[model samples]
Target: MNCLQSVGHSRFSALPWPKRVDAHHRRTAVFNGFVGTGSLRVAAMKTSSNSRSSLYEDETEEQASSLDAKMTDLSDREEKSEIYSSNMTQAMGAVLTYRHELGMNYNFIRPDLIVGSCLQTPADVDKLRSVGVKTIFCLQQNPDLEYFRVDINAIQQYSKELNGIHHYRAEIRDFDAFDLRMRLPAVVSKLSKIVDINGGVTYIHCTAGLGRAPAVALTYMYWVLGYQLDDAHKLLQSKRPCFPKLDAIRSATADILVGQWKARVTFKWDGDDCSSVDISGLDIGWGQSIPLKFDEEQGAWLLERELPEGRYEYKYIVDGEWVYNSNELVTSPNMDGHVNNYIEVFNEDVNIEARQRRKKFMDGDAELTTDERKMIRQFLDSYKDDADLDEEEAEVRASATSDAIASGTIGVPDKA
Candidate 1:
């Protein structure tokens, strides 16, 4: 009998067993080409001795199970690596964006704690008290301009009555005009000392809480918050708007913070040739040191520190007497026809406020009628032609018109 017929199957039994065995061998050879030599060898061995065939089948089943487990392990490792990589990327991104690299978080300074002439209202004082503000630092020089005409004595009396709140005044006129070179470091030192002693919130303010306050605040943001100068300016504007009207102040502030400007001390006689008299007695507001520099050649005293953007009151010590610089330009008025020197530092908040105001007008939400619009345009055009209105005056006029419209004193035209 042929091998195939001997192995069983009716069709193969009818044929010569040898021919059927030959055909089965050919089929095995063809199948082996597709299934691989190892599988073919096992199948061939299965047909041989029964004991050897069983052993080969068991080996083949073991190899298949081993390969499946290996593939599962590789897939699991790949998934784990992908997850780890994604988490690492996110962590790196956060590290790059975080403001405080040394782990100090930015503490929010309560608005009420900040001392200012603008904050003289009863509601504002009450708010300050409620917030547990321990100290008020007034940076204003003139009591008349400052809403509350309370002197140092009055402030001390009030503090005594209030129990916890202490009041200190630094007659800093044009505080914003202090040269940032000398001013920034001195102010920062003073503020740090105050914070250490009070251990509570301290409010530092000048007239509008914009110029001097923002300058000092900006310095704090840089030293404490580790912010770059540009970023520091932006952060200050977010808290309080300070727009520098003076070009020098703007450039000086930028230079100081970015290390673009360096200050050197020099001493000489003025035009009067007064001996190097100690003007140290005069307080230009930022404690102790009289920031006077003598120019030997010009025979004039030049301020070593460039003032920050804002108005300032400064007097040169002539023959041991304090005297204002008549040549210095001023934007705000003072008592003696002497204008207070003003500087405008660039502030993003000013632009933001302007944009918001423009949007309100453009949206027609101000309820401006056609007649009112025509009148407003006429007024603006007239001022432009006359060259009569300064920026502040123009802004005041525009704001008044807008306020009137918003209050319904002006009406919009009906649409057909």
Candidate 2:
């Protein structure tokens, strides 16, 4: 029998104090070959004739079992619906965020980059046409007052003018917060598709050209240019000068950009491999050297190396003359106008600068130890500077050179 029928039988048996009579009633119903709804009615009649027990108990149990099965089915459907709804919401939110970050006051004048005075303006629209910007991604929710308010007709008109693509996404309430990690892939994917189809400039802007616009642009840089988070920030700052005012936005952008960069870019070495050196015991000065000992290989010398991420002041010593490498990459500016590269390592670790400072104080003179000198020299030679010495600077440099030689801080070249 079905679960409903079995539950009905159990309910009839559960009736109070009529143990003998209820058994007799059940036997009479069974002998009559009761079946279907008609049989249930017959069984009810027999039950009433014998005992005044609640006949509704059997019916109630059957109904309860049916209700439970229905509830389970409903629950499964609700779960699936909720999942679909949540996914749809997240996808819509990301699109809206991308548009808001990129759509405001977009200028097509600079086709390669989107220039925005604010988030929206007529001049920007004009510039977009001038630069042959084919796609306009509006991230602003309300070109009017409400977030949902959008200019569908105007967007359609613009699209017709260029016979290009126009997309508008709005950030609705209860929407997910902008997630760089989740959204970057979609943004990059969209950009790549746009570039592939149109092969023209794609301008991205937001209200202030500050938050989302910069973020989307940064993702492009990370994915397209293979820039690390720190490097990408520097590049964007150089281009726009104002981006990511809030610390949280800045931090989040950095994290997302780095994460994307790591996924997209891979590094390869083209030169000979050498031994590792510890320059932690060196003083900070212009001519200090850090020692490095590598396994000797015939016809193969260490061509270049990347220094640990930090600020370092170094000059190359080539053939006994203090020289600077013109080929090395640097991130920050020194006392000189030249830029120095930074190395940002994850995890809390020992400070290279602190170690160098301690070594400087303890050693008195800023001269590099035998081991320290080699490493520092190697670092400088790997990345050289080409700034020509002026007459006045040359004289001062000569004086310093003489002093260094006299103090045995720098070794003189052998005269053959």
Best by lDDT: 1
Against the hidden true structure, what lDDT does model 2 obtain?
0.38
Cand. 2 TM to true fold:
0.31
In the range 1-416, model 2's lDDT, one tens digit per residue, is: 00000111111122122432321132222212434232223334445344443555466446545534543444343343344333322222221121222334433323465644232334345556566664554433353223223344565465544333343232211221223323444444454444444444666654444455566666555444445445666767776654442222332333322221111111111223333332211112221334433335532223233322222333333333333334544344433333322222222243555444433422333323444434433332332222332342353345445645765878999999
Cα error of candidate 2 at position 326, Å: 52
TM-score of each: 0.33, 0.31
Candidate 1 residues 1-416, lDDT tens each?
00000111122212212433321132222321335333233353336588777886787666545644543444343343343223222211111111111111122334433423334333444456566676666555664233233244544465545545555544434422344433444455445444544546777765545455556665554444345445656555565445322322333333332223222323323574665443321124322236456667776765554322233333345665544445544444432233323223323433455444434432333333455434433332333211332453454344445544665867767999
Model 1: residues >4 Å from true position, as ranges? 1-125, 142-152, 179-181, 244-416
Q: Once model 2 is optimally superposed onto the true structure by TM-score, how far is the C-alpha of residue 322 displaced, in angstroms? A: 60
> Which window of ten consecutive residues has the lowest lDDT sum in model 2?
1-10
Local distance difference test, each candidate: 0.41, 0.38
